[model samples]
Target chain A: MSAFRSLSLAMLKGLLRDRTASFFTLVFPLMFLLLFGALFQNDSVSRSHVLQFGEVAVLDEMPADQRRDLSEALNVEQVRDRDEALARVSDGDADAVVWQDEDGRIELRYSAADATRAGTVQGLMQSLVQSANLAETGQPPAFELASDQVEDKSIKPIQYLAPGLLGWAIAMGASFMSAFTLVNWRKKRILRRLWLAPISPGTVIGARIGVSLGMAFLQTALFLGVATIPFYGLRLTGFWWLAIPLVACGTLAFMSVGLVIGAWAKTDEAANAALQLVIMPMAFLSGSFFPLDSSPDWVRAISNAMPLKHLNEAVQGVLTRGEGWGAALPAMGGLLLFAAVLTAVAARLFRWDDT
Target chain B: MGPLNVSNAAGRPEPGATRGPTEALDAARPAPPRGPAPPRFGHGYHRQVTKNIPAIAVEGLRKRYGEVRAVDGVTFEVAHGEFYGILGPNGAGKTTTLELVEGLREPDEGSARLLGQPSWPRDPGLLRRIGVQLQASAFFEKLTAREQIHTFAALYGVSSRRADEMLETVGLTEKAGTRDDKLSGGQAQRLSIACALVHDPELVFLDEPTTGLDPQARRNLWDLLREINAQGRTVVLTTHYLDEAEILCDRVAIMDAGRILRVGAPSELIAELGVGNLEDVFLQLTGREYRE
Candidate 1:
């Protein structure tokens, strides 16, 4: 009884001791709420321009002649030179830049200063180019878009930023916590010591799972508490209550992945890197940064395998679409499956020490 | 069937120089009498006492990491109550072998038994019977010695109201409240040993127990370990200091590249290799080659 008590206390103390980890796990996801809440509402960016880079950067290297047509863009300035244009845009000397690539394409570069404004710019440019592109000419000539009512589909900064922040909290909380602790035990050769005793490997893994799961839940709660403020304010109605457990469950699901990473790597750094390897691409693809609904179908499909996709989708349903766990059940189910698989793998592959 | 096995360290390789007496030392220094003499292992830990039924039976132990064969076809056994040592240079699969024996890993090709039972059964009850001190261990950084001891003690279903008392046993009573991460290397090592002992295990494994400690600390650990052995518990220890092994282990095995080169008492191993000391025997068995 005392040993289990001590184990729980020890695990908690370990979490509290890591200042940086604590901040990331307990603070940052909701910080985005506060930061973005104050910045990117429709009223906030009523007149801002949208810059579409991946699609509209085509004019960046267009011959000086074709570039001349882009001056008509909203807050539109087609900076004639790439480096100078980039500098002005980067330093806020210009609201945005418009350029085309070698393929006789249309492109836009907006100040990344305000992501909301950037998204607004991105939304504006995408619509403008989509409606006016003259493929026969192999370029979209500069044209003023005159829509009395421009459907402003620019995502709120909070909505855009929430998924990635949440995903990071889940991935980081689990990965680092497990990796460092696991490898250190191995390096120290403590597991081997435990082995000479009658203790089974299952007990060791169960204890670790209990420890990491508790931490995972704590990470979610911290993020939720921080969410109470406005920019990061809780946008959900009663349905949000349902998403709470879903999100918490998602956090545990992701932590299981971290456990696997920790179990597989021989060194602490390797374990950490292994976690990032799993996290970075998944976070980007799983709509953690932006809604993947607009992304290609295949891209969206890949996200199904990522824990963050389910997590962000859960958040999106309750917070954005005003749905509940019933709506997010598919993603939640996927998360549970992922959790079960990862836990099994971590347990199966676990080593007692750094052998 | 035993006190909680909180800190039993499984064995690994260490240097065993300045060999002890071949047969005479078994009867040389005696304090507390041990159980009936254990039979020799499949081969032996270090010397040929005899081929005894093993308390730990390792058959064809093997491990692989992508491109590296960490442990390959290594086979050995450890008799109950023997002060066994596995001696080898760094990266010779000694630690890997120990991990397999301890049931941390599943054998890729072989089988291991702990007291006549398959070790991979994942029994919590089994851990309560062993005490271990690892080679490169870590504890909860902010946990005071008292806290760490109590916590680990609970995992194996044992309780010690005296975490501080255990610390005192390890000569760390004054520092019991300090966080483990703040302890000096030697102090940390002491606390680790204390963690392994708080539950009073019957079989204790110590992997490279004195790798980084100063001479005084090493000597202190040796005496402490001797005192532990005097309690009639089996001690399976590993170290790089040949003199320490010679002085401590009743039986020893020389391993190189995941294979046991020889096994006998320190003196017997040296005699078998026809060398003057452990270093000579080691040199004769394995020429100077940097093994990382």
Candidate 2:
């Protein structure tokens, strides 16, 4: 039929026929979902049911005037002895001791023994005071008290990671592995013949880039599907479905970087070396495996610069936080810009017959 | 040995001197195009003078790879419907010059026009209309001959019927199911030609097309070339066999060290050395018997 049909058909067949590439492109994401999914499943997700804090007493030792004023916002209670309440918190008998000190200051003393309880206690205390303070001072807070972050819904690490890891898998397949395939075509003179054809060199490059991006997108979708449908019961609190296209675009942007590598490399070895150099750092620094939120500020800064980190933030924002399309648009725009620049460089510098 | 007598060309004639298979269509290619590319795979002044003018045109074409010149200072023309052969020993730069004219490589120094347009940065229509078979083709070895031809044919934006017809024309229709790795050398060679011509191109470039074939296989391919040329398509071929060149090509250009040492009709080039055979003429010019 037409060249377009033929080219598409050939591209599809080429991908299917190459088992290794196909594995990395299609199956690997699912594999990553399996490996990392199991590796980081949230013990808390299955246990999202309310947790028991054993027995503890609240210190209602605040004066009547202060207790009534702050108790509406904080979890402080009317108790007998304030010193005994402090003792409970230090002994881990209580999760946290909440009360108003003199001068109308809210105080919270909590155990950092259990990370889950510690984080929960810390957030509740801070939010309660912030809310109370906001109401008292009549000044807007730094953040909206009602963040669009899905409320009352808890997520496991897998719920958060499946999409982010899927993006990484697509990046690996589309960017690193694809370079080797192109290098093979170049070594065989197959690409040279294509270059000689009257079709716009743009078409040739475009087709290749298109095929790789398509594969990358597919990988992202497949992994998300596997993780959401089977393992985690597909629960996304934020607008995860809205984040799908953004993740796809972001993955493609990274994959195109691989196209640039493939075009510039003279041999398959050079392509491998170059591609791996790009892939490993992004994987580690993108916060794909662990939350870089707690990483050193410098390390977090480094991750923030990585496309994957932004992709994760962008993805987790949608999937975990149920972020809206409007809020996520800037991240998508950044990825699109990166893709355009890399694509231009790739087209201009690509060589067929390695000189 | 000008254009050979082809009055009795219908039957399969034995390989012999003083004969050509397409003498009947020699009158069709009347004249060559001019300037950039001579406008007429289907148009031109001597549309009827099919057997005249060069199939390719090159002027001061030069190419370099870093320090070495791969194709240097070359100019030549092939007549219409001519089985024009380029004969040179290995590393003699024959392929490089042919590639530049085919638009596979850009000439750093000069110009080449195919079918009357600047060949480099060629138009897709021009590329679709010209066939090229490199010395060695790298195919997806797992694909059958039919599948292989079908895949490349798509790149031309042409109908698959051309691939079917070419497979049949090359006598490989019976073996269309065979993978490239399974095909014998001669069969593989024919398949490459089928892939090249899948667009029904007007000009075919056969670079060392018969390099690895046995004698019988080579003879078979020669007849196929003759039939294709007889159909009024221009054939530009390069070969290591002087005898094959003498038998097949109406004219030949002897290249040495990135330049054309001489160019003329086989008879004229041979006659220039006062020799009666291609081998004698080759020895007279390069002072070497042969390589491979």
Candidate 3:
């Protein structure tokens, strides 16, 4: 126990003294969050719409009060003909086009270029026309159109991004830091010196794991704090404390991979190559930048197998999706299993001496 | 097992009688009289006859790398508290021999016993009783001299004060706060020595301890080594400089082709070879060929 503590303290001191490592571990993730937050500033749950009306006769028949409500709900524009309205929608100047045929049935047209946004606009228009028809006809309605959003309107995209960024922080902290430290130690023959000490390899590895997990927690806390405290002030809900265990599991899962690379690679260059090869693809496919919903089925399949994907889902679930611990169980379990299996492999491959 | 076996001389139990699970159970039995044994110390039985046991014993230790024999059938012993040196040219297996005895490498055949314990066992207790400084003593770059010593000391369950004392012993007190990477060659070497001796082990192994130091620094290190030897600790060192072996070692072994060519006191070996100095003796034994 004393050996473990002393080694861990030494490892922590080494990390603190390394300026480049400190930058990547603590500062890099925060910079990423700030950049993404700035880029996604206008991202919101409720989207604005520009609706072009192809026929003036339909609008003239509506009551003045209903017309005002429709105008307020959308940026209502009157086009001379259907061709002009279709051009506006196709050119991305308008979200949709609405026209009433001679039989009095409402027709809707919109581009499916951005399927999610288009779907939202279509639902809103459908509800609006249904209510308008009922009021104008003065008849008892067969059914009511009621709607509820899972996310609150005030929730910004940055709020959703904060959790994924937290996972990003863990991935960078654990994988990059562990890989570099291990490779550097091996290159310097520091591992050889430690091997001579009256401590087992297990103890040395355990100390490293402890230090990496500690740094992961610190990175997560600092990133979240900077994102929420002085900047976005995003509220984390639904068993937010579970983020602690989630970060731990994620750290273990990622550090195990780093350990394997460090143990297998003979040089620092090789280690860096391996780290980049794994981290870059995982970062993109794991929903760090955008949702994977519209991604190809195979891409989604690969993302599901990634530990980072599980981490992002669990963190976003708690911080943005208002999900409890039960909702995070599958991801947490996947991370734990990944950590266990990879750690076993790393242990088998770990070598104290360069030979 | 047999009624009072005759092999159990001096009223001591037979070696086999104390094997396996019965050893601990029988430890409390009154020890047989062995000619006024020394007072037993913590965790170690100090039998009077233990003084006869050499600090290190190697018998026919051999290691091979494919077709090459790194350490081929080497055999020697260092008396307790003696300064022993192994002198050889590059690639002559001096470091390999040292590493084998240090338990850092496994030998293909034969065995080594340090402090009466087999060196190849996975027992860390043996490591606690011995210290080693490899040829290139790499350390944590950001660790100060004091912290490095403290870290290694903690591994051996030594106190922080002892770590400080080791720094003082190696004349590194003033540079205790300097990061290891920032130190000069001599300072780093001294710090390495201090780390090795932090627990004050019974034996110490130094592989080319002064390989890259200036003359003055080398002389200073020699003085420190002499002091360590005076404190009744066994020291085994490997060096390319024959002068270092002559001036320091009580016994020197000259090796070539993965085997010992000669083993004796420096003066004795030189006199036997009809040479005036170790340089001549080494050249006469190793010949004009460049091993490296």
What TM-score number comes out for model 3?
A: 0.83
Candidate 2 lDDT, B108-206, residue by residue in tens: 999887767678876777887788887777565357888888878877876678788888888888888887778999888988888887777888999
Off by over 4 Å in 3: A45-48, A52-89, A98-108, A112-116, A119-146, A150-155, B1-50
Rank candidates by lDDT, best first. Answer: 3, 2, 1
Q: What is the TM-score of chain A alone in each candidate?
A: 0.63, 0.72, 0.82
Across residues B1-292, which tens digit of lDDT does each residue of candidate 3 receive?
1111222232433222423322321331232212222222211132222476778989999999899999999999887777789998888999889888888778999899998888886558888888888788678759999999988888888999999988887878888899988888888888899888988888999989998997657766776786777677888999988777766676688998899998876656666788766778899999988676
Q: lDDT values of the candidates?
A: 0.65, 0.69, 0.76
- Candidate 3 C-alpha lDDT tens digits along A142-247: 2133212211323466766787777877887798777877888887777767767888988887899899989987887776787776466577786877888888
Worst 10 residues of 2 chain B by lDDT: B21-30
lDDT of 3 at A278: 90
Q: What's model 2's lDDT at B49?
A: 49
Where in model 1 is the C-alpha error above 4 Å?
A2-5, A41-168, A175-226, A229-235, A256-266, A270-307, A340-355, B1-82, B88-97, B105-123, B138-142, B254-292
What's the DockQ for every one of the candidates?
A: 0.35, 0.38, 0.42
Positional deviation of A97 in candidate 3, in angstroms?
3.9
User: What pairs collide in candidate 3?
Assistant: none
Candidates 1 and 3 compared by TM-score, better number: 3
Judged by lDDT, which candidate is best?
A: 3
The TM-scores of all predictions, comma-separated, are: 0.66, 0.77, 0.83
Docking class of 3: acceptable
